[model samples]
Target: MLRYEMQGGIWVYPGKGGWHFITLPTDVAARIKAAMAGLARPWGSLGVTAVIGKTKWTTSLFPDKTTGSLLLPVKASVRQSERLKAGDAPIVTIEIAL
Candidate 1:
């Protein structure tokens, strides 16, 4: 099962990108259930760039210890948004193990 966090006026989503709630009207809970499935896809996870976005302007994941892989740069527009700087505040917490 997926969780839909009711944020702002509309339903915001989890991860670093995309709208949170496709549309979970109160009347029919079934629709919300369907939307949750879509939101929970493997593609729904925060991309590699997003992971790096979580810890920028601070330090690297391996400071003074370089790795072969390189993280993508956060787009200027995204850097200006809440999710990139709000830690996990803007993300709807999902309970995947449950």
Candidate 2:
């Protein structure tokens, strides 16, 4: 397993019913790709366990081709529970099982 801890701002996808996400740091993204790219699911997503504040959930890290990074989706429930919103910088922990 591999674990990463990072701080990033939440942003909403620019579209109707915009989805929220936090983009992993470039350094972290590079490391994750080097270690787990082969294990990624379809569309270059990897299963991961994510934690923020006191909330934890099973989710996936999705590839962001333009940025060459991974984006972690922050679901509505988790966001509300964590008191997070767009533009808020939050520390996030992600664990990937090999």
Tens-digit lDDT track of model 1 for 1-98: 34333221223335577332212123223333334444332423311112222433221111111222111223335445534432323322222212
Global lDDT of model 2: 0.92
Residue 1 deviation, candidate 2, in Å?
A: 2.8
Overall lDDT per candidate, in order of appearance: 0.28, 0.92
TM-score of each: 0.20, 0.95
**Model 2 stretches astray by more than 4 angstroms:** none
In candidate 1, residue 47 scores what lDDT? 18
- Which 10-residue window of candidate 1 scores lowest in summed lDDT? 58-67
